[model samples]
Target: MGRAGDVAVGVVFGGSRVDDGQIAARQFLLELWHRDQQRLARVLLFHRLPITLEEMALQISMARRSRLAFLSALIACWFGASAFTYQLALPGRKLVFPTDHYSHPDFKTEWWYYTGHLTSASGKPYGYQVTFFRFGLRDKQDVKSQPLFTDLYMAHFALSDIAAKKFTFRERIQRGIGDKAGAATDRYLVWNENWRVSGAGNDHRIVVSDRGTALDLNLKSRKAPALHGDNGHSQKGEGEGRASYYYSLTRLQTDGELTVAGKTEKVSGLSWMDHEFGSNQLRDDQVGWDWFSLQLDNNSEVMLYMMRRKDGSIDLHSSGTLIDKNGATKHLTKQDYRIEVRERWKSPKSGAHYPIKWRVAIPSESVELEITPAFAEQELITNRSTRVTYWEGAVQVAGTARGAPIKGKGYVEMTGYAGKLNI
Candidate 1:
């Protein structure tokens, strides 16, 4: 199948010295069409390509009647390819608040992620994660008359019952059909069915319920959104469009009701929220990444991601950010920090070996930390929704900052361990 896709792409570009934009557009179109030809044709075409049928037929040598049919099909494919170009993530994009928080339909992919630690009045410890993802199925112009097939929405809800040594999760996926599932461009509202995250002016609410478990949380941001890597342009690999407009609300005061097994409890804790959008962020050689979001007891935070390649080496584009107690942020290059794996765990279901413990150090900041998962089995096999298997879990942190003893809690996400990630 992949060989066939390569051949199709080559045929499309064989006649012309196509530039980067044209190559990307044709490749994307071919991928969608190859995946589902019937659905792609119906959902992705509203306008025709500007080429004339007579001119197209003139370029080919065939019988008069057969020439017309061939040209018609060729034109349809070209129109579909040319009309579905998405805006790339590039430098110099000035990200604004509240507005940037909304959905970006021009980009190919976008996600809003939240993770935190909560404690009940009785001192019971818990952890939670909620993430909403939007994947563009067609360009904005092509979807004006057919809004339902414009995008795909997915959501994931997870709870870590630390005391019980149990982890539970649910996932939902839906198309942009009517009000059943959608993300608002005019506000910070995104939903897949009843699971949703909505906000206004830095105050947000998250709600999700399924299989006798639910979470209803209200979050208030304590600091401004921290822009990452060159003012929100986070480069993932070497290239013009291999980056993302990324930012994080590292600290949020969270209070909410968590219900598990028909028992509801009021909880309070600190949370971290990340919002990122991009067209093409990963290269073909890149496999996946290890992402960390740490909120320390000193009211400071750190975010780091290490992109791993197929050759078992870390990509030079891997980087991080440090948010000080005052919410000021500093970007860290690949050389600014070091991470060493300390332990590994093998998942019984997926048979994927994962790094579950690590030692992280930032020498310039006089910081060093040892991170370990609260429990080892917080992996999710989401066959029902995104169909991606990964481990995302709450972790415990203990270390030294500026020669002082400090402890913290955070979340770690490791992907592509089960298999090569398609995105």
Candidate 2:
């Protein structure tokens, strides 16, 4: 693995330096997180929703009468915390390297997401996603107890077998206590037990195993990191702080071994990586989003998210980034593109309807694409962590760009369809 800087000696939050008080504050925050977990469980049991407990907790604002108290406390622990405790993702912030590839403990939320399309030597096509999320319980400086760790780590790994029309997924959550799980700030290393993404610079390795399925991949960037929306400040809402520092490795050459159905196969393909960190990224009126990451055969990629409002209109702040063959990026605003759902699939497991097919049009760029899922049932019912049921799967793209026919594979993520993704 390539090392960036020294292992930040001690705990650091966001870009802030850490002290003893910060350690105590993080410990206190963990206590809050633990209590909130229990309270959230009670709220879910009391409300008895078809949704996952994690989703129920996030949707606590809509809880029934009996669970209001517990929900309120949980919300307080998250949104009502002292402002001094955490750093907000604001405009004009410069994102630094290697360190930025790791974790930002000072930010309330951060995620490293990897999605790819692969084919076995036998030509069996597949799609996979591996994501690691770090949720700050409290800033180290805000903790009152000297705990060894402060952040909570959660990971999701999924594999999509296209021809078989099957999708398998697994999730894990860890406290990061005693090295059980955590991320490195001085380098690019994030892990939850054995599942991890570690690298130096733009080269990385991803390893995940569950049940009879596994992926051991080496990823090398083929292009520079593409910063989205105003140089990495991707806005989601109308006001300030409703944004995130988002960047994507639009193209990564992937080579690895994948074990599926008890058979291990060597696979090579293209992958995409997105790393984002921010706090207070959404407005109260926003409910959910439809995000697309498309890598076309034309040596170009597009990343777009359409944020939906409670009133059913699309948020104007919803934007995208387009990466050219040479890694040049162009910012795309709401007016630059349009997304239309072509089909909906109802999940028998959750009784929720989700859009399974879509049409994306970027007229200004002469881009129009029809996206279809590798399978209709790629919904992840994350009961272990994040508790929200969302559809995130690999997709096949067929459309025209610049008046030329093009085809490729990509990934699509739909949130707030099963339950409100308050987080």
Candidate 3:
């Protein structure tokens, strides 16, 4: 559900009609729900298989096709296990809140995502994100009698040094089977050994230091609840149960040390955190999403996303948030935004082209700015969630703020651009 399909494509191939393209994409999505997104398929299932989707197709590249197929197998194993139970479809009518936050086991999956842009002691930029995903095996809470029957908690953390042109990444998968790795509710703690993101009281800390690389972050927010529109009913497509509960904590006064390569330095900047969960988040006709959360130089922030259909048009309800410095929030519906990919990168792995550079236009304020990622190799390949890979990287924001020189830091998450993210 990450590819909001807002970015433009140089050429829409798969089908002559947008509907045809969407149908194909949706088919690809549905098939993957069992194998890829659900984490039902594991590495052992295909470790013996040598097929890597490296061919070229008129639709997407062979790498994507193979990835989609491989991902489907992985999700099937992860979700179809005996540990989780699901509600399948449920009513999503309430505004999602923190108290409402946690694993929606009834649903296929959920993730708590945290990303920050920080500056090192000597004036260097370092960015990183820590995401903890919980997948309910059978939608049934784990029974205490069984030792191996437990849901899976997958953690992915990465560090990007903008000027260094390199990345520090690590991924871990632990079956909540026991206490090797687990998430707690009464207090904030999710960890597996030395790597953990924990907090209680009013403060949060993400500590994951391994093999000399780590992200020791301290988070404090300046804004209240920066919620997504429809009263937290984030519609993905016009269909039954095609929505999610999405919310964000924008503009966190970030202070911590980003350790990468081999050094740890004190850093301070702005950080953003997003927590979203729901049952059946994808529509039959939707492909993916293009999500961007930016902290503008004027002290105001914009959180915008485009949910795209297979047919190339946008889902009118794939909205965003506009928060002012004073902590007030504005609902930005589908009409007030226009985000496009001005440049692209053809990943050597999948050979599927991804829009790496973008020009975002917000007509309401007569604003036009270019947003681009600091690196294109931020695609992560994790076995815990499946072998599916996607782009999640730090971005450099540059443009004029009301005819003045202003720059900022943020992150751009592009999905479906390379192919369906499966997750």
Candidate 4:
């Protein structure tokens, strides 16, 4: 037998001739099988292997004499040597701009998030959020069909009417069915129906219209993308691949139009953009996370996330990044900063008790801040899309930076209050 055939035999029969490549492939396939049998079947069937049913039956018959060998050979034949592999987020993988901003289908999960505080021409204040998500269903290499079923696309659009004391949001979910919904691999364009975000270089545009609420905004980065945790590999839990390639455009000059309740007004503000992608992130014991993105008036920014475990302790791998006015970044470990909950809010819809107020202090940076929600009712019950009940809202920042009085606006996201987040 040739080398490929020999490797296949070793993988199926546990032969002594098994090479390192065969062993790795065997482990990967087994892991995939254990995670989701239905997903594995989809992966295998879509690969379109040339093995005929008669050939497969012969192989199965030969292995039937040994039950262990039969199971191994069956998996090996179904998975095939050309089985696709998803890419994992690992250390030292440098991110390249524009290219990295585009869709990364090799990773299992990715998101493009934009949040900002906007002020209208009429002096009315508003907070807006538009997010696009891509969840890989199967690797592109495994698909031989059109209208690629390789990914599922979802989006969320929300507006916080501070004056009206109201929060309105919309959700969308769709398969990559034609051009109706998909993210481009060669460019930075992602959309779900009419809601879309596209850009080139540091300039971007976002548009979303649902019902009478809409946001047509343009964003230009005021700073370069800040790499979080060891050059964009943000660790979440205690294991290999328990991390994500994370970065943020900490400051984006935003301007456009905002329409609410049939009133359209020109708006301008500062925005934050985060793009993260990875194959695996959360561990089974990790319940969820509390994420903060603060933009201070001093032109500096702080991004922190605390991964909460089932045992009610924070994971040591939870870390953050500090961006200075000049676009420089400094990584912060859990021990470097302190976050204390000052108050909580119980959602009337989901009953999730979320920490609505926080006192964040970073002694090394000489920063102390109190974050409070602009309004208490920004929680989203995303049953129509992500099916996740979480609180994502605009917040007011107050306190001191380097002993100088400072204040700003930001967004806080709290998940797992209703239930453990699946992703």
Q: Which predicted model would earn the best lDDT? A: 1
**Candidate 4 C-alpha lDDT tens digits along 46-125:** 33232232323344434432543434454444344554567889998999998899888778899999999999999988
* Candidate that scores best on TM-score: 2
lDDT of 3 by residue, 266-349 (tens): 898888888776667777677778788888878888888887778888888688787888868788778887787788888786
How many Å off is the CA of 226 in candidate 2? 0.3
lDDT of each: 0.82, 0.79, 0.64, 0.80
RMSD of each: 10.6, 7.3, 13.7, 10.6
Off by over 4 Å in 2: 1-84, 139-149
Q: Determine which window of 10 residues in candidate 2 has minimal summed lDDT.
A: 1-10
Error of 3 at 296 (Å): 1.4
Instruction: State candidate 3's TM-score.
Output: 0.74
**Candidate 1 residues 1-423, lDDT tens each?**
012112334333222355676657656654543454343333223222222334334444455426345434543444443456788999999999989998888798999999999998788999999999887755534311222245677789999999998999998876553345677766788887788898997789999999889999999999999999999999999999999999999999999998999888899999999999999999999989999999999999999999999999999999999999999999999899999999999999999999999999999999999999999999999876677899999999999998999999999999999988755
Error of 4 at 265 (Å): 0.4
Judge candidate 1 at residue 44 and give its lDDT: 28
lDDT digits (tens) for residues 1-423 of candidate 2: 113222232342322455776546645644554555555555533342223324443666554323534433433433333434667778897777766797777688899999999999899999999999987755433222212234667899999999999888989876554344678766789888789899999999999998889999999999989999988888889887888899999899999999997899999999999999988888888889999999999899999999989888999999998899999999999999999999999999998899899999999889899999988899999876877789899999999998999998899999988777875
Off by over 4 Å in 3: 1-98, 101-106, 139-150, 401-405
TM-score of each: 0.81, 0.82, 0.74, 0.80
Q: Candidate 2's error at 153, in angstroms?
A: 0.6
Model 4, residue 303: what's the lDDT?
A: 99
Better of 3 and 4 by lDDT: 4
Error of 3 at 223 (Å): 1.3
By descending lDDT, how would the candidates be arranged?
Answer: 1, 4, 2, 3
